[model samples]
Target: MQPNQFNVDAANKLKIVSLVSVGKHPQSGRMRRADQDSRAVELGLKLTGDNHSGESLVVLHAGDPGEPNLRSYAGMGLKSVRVLQLDPAADAILPLGQHLQQCGADIVLTGVRAESGESSGMVPYQLAEKLGWPIVPRVADIVSVKGGVAEVLQALPRGQRRSVMVKLPFIASVDSAAPEARQSAFGPASRALMDIEVVSASVDDVRQAWEEAAARKRPKRLKVVKAKTAAERFKAATAKSQGDGGKVMKNESAAEQAQAIFDLLKEEGVLR
Candidate 1:
């Protein structure tokens, strides 16, 4: 599906919202505009541009309104970004869902996952469930919208593509394979407004206990040996694992062999 190929009348009148989040640099650990979320905003821009309509699309954020990085998102030719002010530890789902449900928007776009925090990619799914709207996940682009139905192109594994038709008032998670976002300009970004709204904060008890830290790879689990009979069990237990490039101890004593196995297990962190 190519860009700018949607119905002009529908595009002009279409109410769209794109959800954005603060992104983190993988190496430097600095905040920036999220990648997939930026593409979502780009998609929304194209949706309105199809009809040469301006300001028909609304950009939204659920966290801090004062974050300097948010202006980068506004730099994408957006007039302002509507923000739902909440405590850092509060959950965004409740307020976001409530706002979206009452906003009467035809389409809601978001990234498949955030670059910061948990990055579980559950926000779109949870928002869809909250509003009782069907979601089209990993969508590369929306081909067209007509007759209250949207034809969307979904990104599949191995560079495959699939087309799905979803009704209006649906949620879509933009894929990384979607069109790259436009470069942000400093002039427009500086002049754009951060429209903050007053909202009651709902603390997220679950996230309150979260401790962010670096990740570590886990040890590969050893395959379990199964046997039906006692003789089979003994044979299986004593049998050497079938793999090339492995150390083999054929003439070693029982105690020495047991010690070697114990050391290997300890090195692998299989034993506490």
Candidate 2:
């Protein structure tokens, strides 16, 4: 099949890649739910194909071969899919980039954060840096693709949205606002097999030393805002609030009560 013919539902198509990690279950130490891994497979499907008609799709699952999560990922979708095995000890970010570099995918889609591992939400940035490609983080939708540029919708805080266009070979960290991934259609997915594509990289190219990344000085840590105990939480809830005591007195006449309340809150640091 021709390269661009991928959109025609031919046997070959571009690949969406996701990194999977084995996460220990919070309750059962023996078994884990591959939620992040499965979500990755889910995002891959939405990014590469429309619900009905579109290109054939492939999910490139990157992780260690022996991780049981690999089987779960394999069951996620079907057709032209691959489970890429990396060194069991390899740090994921760099090795993932090396694998994608060899995979020749048109686009790489990953979740904003993994359920396991460091959970730093820095993998897409690190992978883009290593691969020398652009990254669009927290993307809510793939709006359109034409002429090697894909336009995307990005989710911002306070329910705001922004539009961006990135060239092919770009990385996108899918936000939860994107369309829900479909359930694995068993007939097709069960028919699929694990086609492993092994990518070996030069040892010298991988970045190590967490200290190097820490030196960059990113966002400051937000306060935890958590109560240490249930009693503490109850005490905090019952404690007298900012207006000197339980009740916030309106300094103005009765006609202006609502406005006065708002103004009092503004003065007391309760409202922005």
Candidate 3:
């Protein structure tokens, strides 16, 4: 479907549930960076508006309990947020879907993947399977949602794009290709003291053991190559191997240079 055909103003009105991973920021390295969580919230807010029908934005977190990031999301124009906490040991997909189902979320949105732990890049697909909802990865926009269906724009390789229509309660994994997430203002971030009511887990046995697991083993040897700069990285990329012999070339015409370059690339298996 063409993206221009759908009505974005209408889609922005539907209720949305945003799933996110609360983690340390790559730049700040804080324990739980609100900036990252707020970024995800910003996208959710933009797609589905500051309010979700009458239900607030649902920020589902896995593993971490501190949840310091919720404040930033609240600061960044989100009217309300629901924190669905789950057992850190349980399967992330199952628990996340269970919580979202209880919230009655019409559309579930999440980042492509988390920045910490497994970062599997499989949460959206897995959650969709568990919830029997359509999964759309690399989502760029929500154009419309009506009659229990939603129209969305998805990013494709090489700058290509496509629009699709999926039923409500579908799952979409937001890509970096979507609009850049905004920074949180300092005043709002500091003053926002949102309430966080931790929900108790209902599961008794949450552990899953690998069948062929063995005692943690360490490798006998280690090899490390560090490059401090871009030039060093390029040098490493073009470095000669132990079995490779250096070659001598004479200055030549443009065509000869081109042929020599092709020959070198072919020898290095860079050209086929």
TM-scores of all models?
A: 0.79, 0.59, 0.63
TM-score: model 3 vs. ground truth: 0.63
> What TM-score does prediction 1 earn?
0.79
Error in Å for residue 15 of model 1: 0.6
Q: Say which prediction, candidate 1 or candidate 3, comes out ahead on TM-score.
A: 1
Clashing pairs in 2: none
lDDT for every model? 0.87, 0.61, 0.64
- TM-score: the better of candidates 1 and 2: 1
Give the per-residue lDDT of model 1 (tens digit) for 1-272.
Answer: 46666666677778899999999987787989999999999999888763222288889999889999999988888878899998888888999998987888899999999999779999999999999999999999998888889999999999899999999989999999999998888888998988999687778888887777787664444557777999998887777665433477879999989998898778768886
| Winner by lDDT between candidate 2 and candidate 1 | 1
lDDT of 3: 0.64
RMSD of each: 9.6, 14.4, 13.2
Residue 21 shift from truth in candidate 3, angstroms = 1.5
Tens-digit lDDT string for candidate 2 (66-132): 5544454455555545656665445556666666787687777777876555667887898889989
